[model samples]
Target: MTSFRQSDRLRNVRYDVRGPILTEAMRLEAEGHDVLRLNLGNMHPFGLEARPEIVDAVAAGLAPAQAYSDSRGIPEAREAVAEHYRRCGIDDVSADDVFLGNGVSELITLTLQALVNPGDEILVPAPDYPTWTGAVNLTGGVPVHYLADEANGWNPSIEDIESKVTPRTRALVMINPNNPTGAVYSEETVRGIADIARRHDLILLSDEIYEELVFGDARHHHAARTAGDDVLCLTFGGLSKAYRVCGYRAGWVVATGPLHRAADLLEGVTLLSNMRVCPNVSGQYAIPVALGAGAPGSPLPADIVDPDGSLERRLALTADALNAIPGVTCVPPRGALYCFPRIDREMFGVADDEAFVLDLLHTEHILVTHGTGFNWPEPDHFRIVCLPDEHVLTRAVASIGDYLARRRR
Candidate 1:
């Protein structure tokens, strides 16, 4: 019998957040060991529950969900997404400019599919969520990684991004409040990136999924607002991170700025959206109530996780704990539920981060993602999800410290 093989297109696609190391962690758990999973930023396992309003609203709309919604999404959900962005300062958006999907994951693939042709270049940040890289490759485009300088608070180096642009470059993907590195882009940084996009005539793809999860003084500018009025920008965000409803698969993409120029691209996106028939209908039902919370001055449940008041207490404590380990220094994440810490390779004499991660898992029973897994060129860093409880984070990092000490021997 012949074994089934994956397509050649999947060769460059990688999502190491749940890749090999996670598979090993699962194997250990099945053998009956209690593994502390810090590999993924999943909220529910850490005690977050779906809010009452979101649940009730979806339940109330369950009847209509039996039928397919409009290909772009039911009008109510699209309007809610549009209104959310409008409040964020992207005033040009309307229901027609918004497209709903199961999650930002689907929208990202669709957006890339519509825009990229074979060999087209897409400038993306280093140390990014692998999905962005995977999407570009799957769409037959090349992902050109531009360094996001760690020394500069993990902000994208404008010089690096600009230097990589070629005539074939079609777009720039910005993951604000970045995944592996939680550095939120300051206002100046956001504008600088937008200026590059405008000068090069590149479509701006902004992933703002973690926009609502900022910590400390880390400022995040809405990419749509910062991209200027003449640039075409698609900003993607969803209920996964903000509302702690990753399982609900409710997410959206909003077109903004001078998007009218890309009439053909937007139509391509719509046709693809229709190819899927519609996103999860049940997921579509929860949008209005979830987003109905009034404008800027009005408080919404999303604000609870913002820095200083909500998860700040845990984030602050976790950052301190990780940095306390000798030769392990982590920039306290300004936003998002992750800590990407640099490991002094000379201190441990381990050159492969993936091996280091697996050794830590086997010895400490704590799972983490390696930096190379997120496409870091060096083996000097690893990503740890900070979504666990205060005590869990404490124990997990302490285990890592002990494991590091052993590696030093």
Candidate 2:
């Protein structure tokens, strides 16, 4: 019998957000624990439904999808994606440059695998989406953490980025309307990052999956639009968040600007796409309808929207409630469906973020991911999904407050 050993690449990866804690939470819930799950940002589980038009289109195309389509993607879906980017002010992108896959998760991995050489470095945000770090590591590339300044509303610091770059740095990742913190970068910030990319000749990987979920008065600048032809950019987006179709597993990556230099990288993606054959074909069929002109009626329920049909009211409700809790102070989220709050370690006698989360789960029956889960260097924070009903969120926060008060005693 042969002894099997785990790969070294897998050894360094730690996805604490969805790892042991989530697993234990699920197990406890299966046994009838009343767990208010605020860990994952997935919208489907919180009652966000897919657009009716999208559903109808996917149903219509199901039979045809039984056969293999183009490796890049179904022609119509790729065309729709290309047009979507054009509308978003990214010029010179075409269907030929689009590669569809099973969610942005698959596309991110494919892009990293294609571009990274062993010991190459990619600039990723500290307190970033863990998958960015994991993907870079899996490809034998090092992920250098660049600080997103919390003092400046969680914006990426240009000086911090410049200080981190080395000859080995080959790419920079931009998660606008970032995960966990939910801070949307301004146009100035985007341009600054783009300038750095141009100066260093690094590929810009913009993960804009939450582009349509901007809340309050915040505006999201498409990074590729500002970066122009000097820098090669790959913008990744999909139907997961905005369209509320996570199960569809539909995502596309668009290559823009100086794509000629990336011929080998593009070919690698093509080969990888061919190996998978195609993304979920049913999901591909729905892209046109989802990205097309608005559906006749509002896809969301009235309660889900404010009178202005914006998510601002809900955002405020969650932010205010979280801030009201002792030992918890969340910077108001501008976009995306999360509020990452810094927990006061001294106030609650909480030694670390994971310990705080574990205590909350055991006592309050609520689940949240620790800061370390998102590659945050310190244990002073935790992320909360803001999709729960206003009343439910209020109760959850109050429960956390009660736990804090008890701990202080």
**Top-TM-score structure, candidate number:** 1
Local distance difference test, per candidate?
0.87, 0.85
Residue 109 displacement in candidate 1 (angstroms): 0.9
TM-score of 2: 0.95
Where does candidate 1 stray beyond 4 Å?
A: 293-298, 306-310
Error of 1 at 130 (Å): 0.6
lDDT of 2 by residue, 241-286 (tens): 8787888899989998998898989999998888888787888887
- TM-score of each model, in listed order: 0.96, 0.95
The predictions' CA RMSDs to the true structure, in order, are 1.7, 2.6
> Any residue pairs clashing in model 1, and if so which?
none
- Residue 100's lDDT within candidate 2 is 92
Which 10 residues in a row give candidate 2 its minimum summed lDDT? 298-307
Steric overlap count per candidate: 0, 0
